[model samples]
Target: MASQGDRARDALLDAAEELFARNGIDAVSNRRIVEHAGAANHSAVAYHFGGRDGLLRALVERHHEEMSRRRRELMEQLGESPNIHELVTARLRPLIELLDSLPKPSWRAQFMSQISAVPSAVAVAKEVIGDANLPDDLRFINGAVDGIPESVLRGRAYLLGSMVVGVCADQEAKMNEDANKGNWEQVGRFLIDAAAGMIGAPVTDPDGAVRYPNVPLI
Candidate 1:
């Protein structure tokens, strides 16, 4: 049986997620979270999660455990070798699946989208869920865009993160308006195709000059 403390903690997390997703993280107060959770104690957030940062870490870690499991399963099925598309699919599908598993009007995507914009919150997220640094395919991607300027390569990496987070957040917001409005599987496939295309696209210099040095991309 779950203790009252555990139940209170979970309530606080749920309230915080919804509040933060709907009204940016910084805008939501700890007191508001406690009240929203229906906890008698005003310090419920502190007592349950230690503080705001701890609360954020707990939220990220909760989803991260499932995500890690799904990612491991996907990677195992890929065997020893996988192409860029397969690798991108493996990396992305777990998140899409996670979002799919969530109930309608979910705030997970928006929660993460907001977190990504805050450096401190993003650090906690990265600490819990790891970053976008895909080491295994570094060499492969480097070779794929060997001739492209490092600036362009770096820009694409940033854009890909924003694209995934932004699109998911937007879709979730839309779904809240009409439960049957969106198809996440289709969105996931489109994202996979778009990401793979961006990664594999030929580098065409608009000007006849290269701006960035030929640095090996990470």
Candidate 2:
């Protein structure tokens, strides 16, 4: 059983997520969240979440929880051992699905872009989603890099992560540029294929590097 206050708080969080995802954290005001939540108390944001920063943390936590749930389910479906490509696909599928599930894609796109642009938000994101948070289905992907030296793995992982972020950011930018002209479903599919290809490509030594399969620039 939940109290009325609890219900109000939950409503506030829901409204905040909707606004924050669409408009970016800084763009949305506490008053707007309270109004959107249908709360009469003007201090609802502070009462429920301490303040704006607290609200932002709550939003980030909500995303983290949703991601963790999807990751767990995907891992459970994969069984004991899966290959690198499977691991990469499993890791990416939840993210694609999460974005697709949002009611307003434009809002989500703007929200994600804003988060990426903020250095502090980036640090928070990295802390919340470090290597330990990698799903079990994708463990083999990490294992695949075991043959590569630690330094090389670190470098490659950084590069690959940046590539994936860039792909997502570009998709968001394209969506913003021509809302009616682009389809996320199609772009998401292409991204998954492209990411899988990159994950499957062989790693090279740090020294200048050998010729490897070129990751197609999109």
Candidate 3:
């Protein structure tokens, strides 16, 4: 069984995630989180998490553990070699699976999206969760294309992150409406297809010169 302190800490995390999702993370004060958590101590957040930054890191690390586990399993299933599409799916599927498992009115996706907007928070998240850029993953990506600049590939990787976060946030937000329910399966497929193309797409220079014009997209 969890101790009372553990329960209080979890309550604060839960409340903070919801409030941050509903009202941008910057707008939701630590006091609001404490009150929403129903903790008797006004300094419960500070006592439990140290501060808002610590609380955010805790929330991200909690989910990242599960996501990382799922990614490892997916990567293991890929065996010795995998194509771009398979690699992209492996990288992206965990978030979709996590969201699918959540009940209605989930705040996780929105919370992540809000966090991505804050550079400091994003750095903290990167410190905790890292990214999809595993060694093998990067090796595969680097050799997947020829003549494309490494700089362009780096930019595409950042684009993929922003795209996934923004799309997931939008889908979660629309869950409140009667019509237009979020279709995560379709979303997953779309992301996988789009990301594969993005990862291996031809790089064009400003002067209309295309690098790796023969690059095949997945």
Models 1 onward score TM values of: 0.84, 0.67, 0.85
Deviation in Å, model 3, residue 102 alpha carbon: 1.6
Q: Which candidate achieves the best TM-score against the true structure?
A: 3
lDDT of 2 by residue, 1-218 (tens): 99998889878877876686666766778999899999898899998888876766666666667777887687778867676666666666676776667554444444455565555555555455543233244445667654554444444444555566566766765666676756667766776777666655666645643232222111
Candidate 1 runs further than 4 Å off: 131-154, 205-218
Q: Which regions of candidate 2 deviate over 4 angstroms?
A: 1-29, 32-40, 79-81, 123-127, 131-139, 145-147, 169-185, 204-218
Off by over 4 Å in 3: 131-139, 206-218
Count the clashes in each prediction: 0, 1, 0
lDDT for each residue of candidate 3 in 1-218, tens digit (9 for 90 to 100): 99988998888988998999999888888998899999878888789888878888898787777877888898889966677888888888998989887877788888888876566677677677664343344546666567766657655666777788888888888874543684888888888899899888777662442232211111
Query: The CA-based lDDT of model 2 is what?
Result: 0.62
lDDT for model 1: 0.76
Q: Judge candidate 1 at residue 217 and give its lDDT.
A: 16
Report each candidate's C-alpha RMSD, comma-separated, in the order given: 4.5, 6.1, 5.3
